[model samples]
Target: MFNNVYPREKYLKKIRPFYDSDIIKVITGIRRCGKSFILKAIMNELIDRGIPKTQIIYIPLDRRGYKNIKTSEELETKIESMLGDDENYYLFIDEVQNVFGFESVIHAYAEEGYSIFLTGSNSYLLSDEISTKLTGRYLNFETFTLDFSEYLEMKRFFKKKIDQDIYVEFEEYILNGGFPKTIEFDDIQARQTYTRGIISEIFEKDVKTRKRISNVPVYERVQSFLLNNYSAPFSLSNLLECLEKEGYKTKATTVRGYIEDLKKAKIIYECNRFDLKSKKSLRREQKYYLSDLAIYFAMNTDNRLSYGPSLENMVYLYLASQDYQISIGKIGKLECDFITRNTSGDYAYIQVTYTMQGEDIKATERIKEREYRPFRKIRDGYPRYIVSLDRFRDQQEGVHHINAIDLFLGKEKI
Candidate 1:
């Protein structure tokens, strides 16, 4: 139905309500996160809904035909020549940020009631400038590299051999990550190599070309630090101290600026800490999660799985993709892995661990208590959970312990 395009229903379900509406759909993500592929899937949806192929326009600015259209005027002329006075036209443009001053052109079409869709590799498409120009005209839906479920499904789509034991595949999913394109490669070496290529492509086209870094070496160190230590909490001062300890002299401001550049380029996402006592968000000691675990695997030589942080990172991406506003919850000495709020003001607290089963009798109970302690301290009656790889799905102290495999495979929900 998607013309060889694997359907990302998580995305399509959100956009389906506005399929034929006048609202402009904006899809943004890291490089090669299948932004363009989702655009094609949307076009196929339009066709299945009885929209003619002629009335649907697919223009990828980075591709050969439109590569020369670098200015807004050129883009406007091309789009104008393609439109006609027939039924409503469904316009899809990938890599829309390639053309300078392209917002006005997109806004122009949206204003004319054309059903417009756009995808960009970096955050430039949703910058303050673009926001000001297209205010109240577009609804953005961010995409991620694949989540665990999609990773397994995509392998099936390509006819890759499947293992009956999902735990075997789980290891691969965590190490290989969820980049849709990277799944095309069968071996870990090829997949990791392709992922590294994506990292380089993003830096060249989005990061380096858009932002200037005077000290490339220092920035590289900072990048390596963040990539190597995903899901760890650190402050600028802490980072500065670490750099000084390593014999690298750089100011906190320089480190801060480089981190901002990486975040803006969609390579990393920062998660703030929430003080459960004060009911406020804290700026310091925040954790940063990589766009995909494959990013960490591609950049580092550590193949050993660190389930604590890796599972937490996977849950973070899943919650974010499901449109949950997430933050670290701090209650005095105790901490909850994530405090999430849905669009309807519903709240859910989560704790992620490798297992609830301990090495011994005391250790098993200690593991369970360690994970559920923070949830017990919470004053509110919001839904609390402990997500782990434990085979036992039981409840302790009113906290539900769910298997990570079940949580990701849609057999359960947090």
Candidate 2:
């Protein structure tokens, strides 16, 4: 059904390191984030390397053909029947969590020396049961929707170019998001419809059915609240109060459960507040960003309301996908949008704003005091940045002010 192939080299680079290893490769992400396509790409790579098709066992439990394999035993029996004696095999299972007792089957296959690769749509795929069964035997690769570079690749695939000005494309990207399937549609309505359908499938299969939540309307209200207030700090009590104001009488614990369910399904990401001065994690008033900005656009139907938060969410997702450990920064009364720690123990303090170019001195000073001063308060030597839409350069006092588009396009390094 796809017209062009979008080379997801970032994920492929991650998978290449462990190719043919005994450890199980587990790929987890939100629904329709191209997990199945990644598997197909990997299988094609294996075939190109002279691996026989007969030796590679691929099963997609979500498909109708595999609907009969409801139990772990049935899955194992079918897989085992395809294997031959005394030979290496590659097993690719998509949405493997559909079968109960799947961990046992994975363990059995691992014991037989088969190189196993699997994908699932929820975090529950790596819950305690699976972890305990496959302890020290698996590696997880968390996938996300397309990054800006990948989105650009998709645009190029359709023979569209934005060489002179990219703000036009970036604006559309900020609205439609980077879901692989949604990138093909030139029509705004079609893109929104596609993303709405993805949210519905996630709600139905991943949240409602998986969590056994019968009150879907209540659950949806909680989702709407989160999407509307994306990048804002709110607690369980705050969510409870909002729901109460909406005439939905739900307890704080129920709201917390719903939030957790959305997080597990990868529909939204939660960022905790970290006290920069005290070097501790704050418990209350956490921020949540949606898995894709298109979700908020699909639900709200107005991009203007979510414009600023959408930019912040985009920065958060980009940093996260690059393997940064991110948290909201709070230094006493002041707040910084993101505090990211890289793998090498390097830290970066980032503040994202829509624009910092207005001719109003009061507005610019407000941004500096609120967003820039917090970075100055830190005594530690680390890179600090203020990412916004302004093209002007304001690199002073050890703080770098960069355009958000340049950051997303890899023209500027963090």
Candidate 3:
């Protein structure tokens, strides 16, 4: 009965292999990142594959009719009423974490021969019970806000007006970000308002309510600090000092815990630093990038794009959504924008900039050397790239100069 549900092929490809498998499929991501739509998309796929619509039970507990179902017992009773006598049922639940004691009920249903799929907004959904009871019985599928390519594709799907200029389109992508519902809005003010509501919703439903922040004021302070300084590296001591300066006066553990809470909420993602000389990932001095660029823009009134970190943030999200394990690369004092390892164990080093053009040839040479120097320090044969917003491409030594728009649009691959 759902209409205008744009398909998410990226998640579907990962889910399709387990479509008929006995193991429970668990999907997790940030709120408003289209996890529910993926559930509906899977349902549509099942019907297309000749699975009877009646045999597929989709329960979105957050909806009006189901929101009143709170406890596990209530959920079990509701699910029982929906189930038929068939053993080949495909069951899907969205935001399943809302129901207390939901683990046992899902485990029980999984054991009873239902091909189950589930989604939750935060990491807590996988903790405690599911980690123990459903251990080794389910596979987790990580979902993300749309990549740049999908952003344009989705706009086309809804027949929204799109900028013909690639740079303009890219600028809009980073500014408005890739939330599926945000596309339905017409103006920047509307989009920003929508994203701001998302932030409040995340803190209200996912953080304060579920995670239980005893000191709301302190937590909000930390959140604001992190959001305003997004993409910059900060030490816990530094953060603690900053909090104290603001008269928030919290303990290290409290600040640390709040940071973890933000990460779990998917408002901020932690990126650890990797030491090339030591061949290890450092535990401290990590940078946190926003899950979507809109998070930063929505929270702050300063709409001017800080090109350096902004471009870096876009590259980070792009690589991450493509399933790359990313780390900030350090070689002595020189730093690479990102050091990434794909699922297949392939490594790639990337440097990002807003543009390569400069006032003079000498200035341009200096910029090029700074971007390429880190790649030279690494003796690995893996791909190295200097990605920028330049309209043209450059091939210097073994390093590739690529346009950022092309990279996000899937026209180029590192």
Each candidate's lDDT (Cα)?
0.88, 0.85, 0.88
Tell me the lDDT of model 3 at 237. Answer: 85
**In model 2, where do residues sit more than 4 Å from their true spots?**
1-4, 158-164
Per-candidate total of colliding backbone pairs: 1, 0, 0
Q: For residues 285-309, what per-residue lDDT tens digits would candidate 2 score against the true structure? A: 9999989898988887566745578
For model 3 the TM-score comes to 0.97
lDDT of 3 by residue, 62-120 (tens): 89899998999999998889878776888898999989989889888888788999999
For residues 127-161, could you state the per-residue lDDT of candidate 1 as single tens digits? 75568888888899999988888888888888888
Report lDDT (Cα) of residue 126, candidate 2.
79
Off by over 4 Å in 3: none
Lowest summed lDDT across 10 adjacent residues in model 3 is found at 124-133
State every prediction's TM-score relative to the real structure: 0.97, 0.95, 0.97
Error of 1 at 378 (Å): 1.1
